[model samples]
Target: MSVNRATMQGAFDLCELFQMGGVPSIIAGGAARDIYFGVRPKDIDVIICGISMETASEILAGAGIASTPFHIYNGAASDRLVGGFKLVGTDIDVCLYDCTDVSEAIDAFDFNLNQFVISGIHHGIDGAHVRFVGEIHWSTLAAVRKDFTPARHDKMQAKWLDLSWRRATGEAVEVPVGGLDGPY
Candidate 1:
């Protein structure tokens, strides 16, 4: 599979926008996994580090990006998600973490595949852009190439099965993993 141009462009543009707003962020989770596999991401997940949800909301709103609060309900406990925004035909979900660096946020991911991130975005007036950054976890590369998911949580087993099937058949399959949001 080849990289999806539109999805990647949207990710890059979002990173640039956040950078311009002086808020450091990175694209991670399923979106990064898809990008590494040369597949178009279903949606882009952004991790905004070292900021409160209110501050992040202000930055997003200032950039003309309207976002809605996202929450994951797990029984009696409801997990509040940062925000969900749409940009360039792509759904971008933002997660606010109280961390100083993108790596810290990436470390909170449950699986290695979702741990990969796109960072170090550089925008230039001369059109010399260098958007790709961050190292791909070895386990993530192995899982995707070998069509297997490393043992982590028992709940994620089905997700691996669906991923394998998707890879073999080239079909998009949605497997609900009990509202498993990335990195809180």
Candidate 2:
């Protein structure tokens, strides 16, 4: 499916906010992967340099946008609901500069496909210049007939639970091959 025009701009607007704030930002996770597949992202994930909720709100507030502080993750720089951004369940993770870099954050992703970022915020740039970052892995282009990777690393479990839930709701996943590397 082609991406919706509104969603595309919404992603840009959300990510660009950090760029404008002098914090280099990258759009990561499922949205970045799904963009390559021409699918509308289920959610948007923007990883940015250290920024507090107060700072984010201040930025958005200047743009006449409204935001709500929602502490979804502990220790995160900010977890908020940004208004005027047309994304469903949008999340922005702020990594402190001293703690983590963008590449490190990408490496910590659960799956290979997820370990990518689209950085529109170029450093030492004058205007709002943007560009895609990282190379798409051969694995991401390949089908998932191989092993199942963890949907989350902290839990260290594959998507079995999520698939099972889908199954219960009559959306069972079918394995293309007879075997898979990890538990499915």
Candidate 3:
């Protein structure tokens, strides 16, 4: 789909929502990459930190979003899959996690945001401005060792390996994180 201003705005709105009340959330999955590239995302993945999975669900529910049951399959904490309203048809995946999980992810992941080059300036509701920072997720996962299915891992590895080869050949490289492997 063609990227547009509204797409970026939705992401900004979600970011604001989390910052104003959600607290300690990291934009992950598609939203993170899309925002970084000045595009709107089909889904917004908000990884919540600092609250119990149940408490996070309650908070999300109060905001008119419904929480999905916690599952061991997704490798996400507790997720809230939301849609409709002004964000109709868009998926808002809220992954609620504890503070310790967030900290550990930051500490262990080699591709974590803590190790990336982030620019402060970004597009927002008011055009180009310095409103948010681009966070990298791979390092965080590498640190935390959040596993995925092997098939998924293989697919992701193939992509990364391609990029790495390109980089070796003097081309720009974009890193990837999600894939199969782990307990998921």
Candidate 4:
């Protein structure tokens, strides 16, 4: 799959806006996975580290982007979200993490495929620049391309869960032999 130009442009716009506001952020989660597969993501997930929610809201509002408080519950805790906004018809979910750096934030993701991040937003006199943050596992690429669902980390249990859900859903799920250390 190839990236949808419109979808990527929207992500870049949001990243540029946050960068100008002095907030270091990255596009992670399912949005990054979609982009890797060249698919148009339904929404973009942006992760900001060591920033207050108030500051993030101010930055978005300054760009004429109004954001509403957004939350995601994992059945364990209520209100695990910070805020979300829309730009060019694409929903952008902003998450404020306690992480001190990008790698730490990436490590907190539930799924390997969702762990990849797109960061390093730079706008120069010539043009804008952005790139993926880490080296994705070859297995991750193969799994995505083959539509093979992998195990997800069970945060509460602190262990990996088998592909039971995928099997229940009739999806072809493959767990590489010896297991995977990171996103592949």
Candidate 5:
């Protein structure tokens, strides 16, 4: 994907905000990838290693940021895995870090670019720090920069899945809260 300025600025601003808490945040999932390519992510997934959900919730509560358990999961209904929190209106989902380190976490994603971590992001998580898999496909990535192509269409379908997920979970889709909320 072709990097752009606005998205880069957004990543820096987000890092600035995260650093305010004085905690190391692992930017995971597709959000990391989007930030790498200078694409403003629809939602942000952050992971912290040393904090419990209760502690994290308390911190956010003290900061006036409403947070609740992130209900989205990929496994069976009976399985309770990876407790996380979703900050209301901010599109931020904070997950409790597991044994999987940032390196392994990034590799679990569907795409190469989605695999990354900007370690020790202080008051400034610059775009230059965005890491990725050793390999990259310029042509496929470039297609993401273009508008209304198959990639975009495929993304739209993926957005539909999110909408379905929300509906199934009794959650409402909102641009501020994170759903399909862009050109898609």
Candidate 6:
């Protein structure tokens, strides 16, 4: 399947935004991973390292984009919704970690984007792919595993719940696999 033109275009716009500023950004959440396999996320979540909160906000706000503040104002640089998604909900979240904090997290494990694999799914546009980016910070992943990971995992779980709800309502639909990682 091919990526939805609109969706892929938005992803490029997002990449361009960060590239212009020379910021190190990772396309996170389902969208990133989905890209490799040809699936488009309903929302995009991006992680930007080493950015100041003020600067992060300014960038997104300047673009006239809206974002959920939950990740922002929590010592994070910020999060922004670069564009809208029709299927997977694509939203980008930037977590600007201090240099010291990033170093500490990296030291905990030998991580890189290579550890991840891109898988396929039938969602949005056929053959649509998203960028999963990859896991790098073990410390942060470990800490988030306890809480945020569950919520992330819940994204996939909700699919099943949605299916069940649909069945109960006499609508038949098949649930798609979350991705190579099985949703978490």
Best model number under lDDT: 1
Checking candidate 1 for backbone clashes, the offending pairs are none
What does candidate 3's lDDT look like per residue over 36-95, in tens digits? 333344555545566565666566567775456554444434222212122334455555
In the range 1-184, model 6's lDDT, one tens digit per residue, is 3334454445456545764787555434444434333344555544455566667667777787665444323322222222221223443444454443322322221223211222232232343333322344211222222223456455545543433332344222222333353232
Q: Give the alpha carbon lDDT tens digit for every residue of 1-184 in model 2.
A: 3334444455567567767767656666565544433344555556654556566566766876554544433332321222122223334333322222556555444445454454432321122222223344423232222333343342323322332232244221221101132110
Model 4 per-residue lDDT tens digits across residues 1-184: 3234455555667767776767767777666544444345567777776677677778877877756765444422222233444443456667776556656766555445565455433432123222234344323322222222244223312211222222244332222111132121
Worst 10 residues of 3 by lDDT: 175-184
- Ranking of models by lDDT: 1, 4, 5, 2, 3, 6
How many clashing pairs per prediction, in order? Answer: 0, 0, 17, 4, 0, 28
Instruction: Mark the 10 consecutive residues where model 5 has the least summed lDDT.
Output: 170-179
Better of 1 and 4 by lDDT: 1
The per-model lDDT (C-alpha) reads 0.51, 0.42, 0.41, 0.50, 0.47, 0.40
Q: What ranking emerges by TM-score with the best candidate at the front? A: 1, 4, 3, 2, 5, 6
After superposing candidate 3 on the true structure, give the runs of residues whose Cα lies further than 4 Å from its correct spot. Answer: 1-7, 34-42, 73-88, 100-149, 161-184
Model 5: per-residue Cα lDDT over 2-121, one tens digit each: 323344344344445444666445666566545444355677667554455676677767766667776445642332235777766556667665433444444334443344455434
- Runs in model 5 lying further than 4 Å from the true structure: 1-24, 71-81, 107-113, 123-128, 133-184
| Candidate 1 error regions (>4 Å) | 1-4, 71-89, 123-155, 159-184
TM-scores, one per candidate: 0.59, 0.51, 0.51, 0.57, 0.50, 0.43
* Residue range with the least summed lDDT across 10 consecutive positions in model 2: 175-184
Candidate 2 clash pair list: none
- Superposed Cα deviation of residue 72, candidate 6 (Å): 6.0
The global Cα lDDT (0 to 1) of model 5 is: 0.47
> How big is the positional error of residue 149 in model 5, measured in Å on the Cα after superposition?
24
Candidate with best TM-score? 1
Question: Who is ahead in TM-score, 3 or 6?
Answer: 3
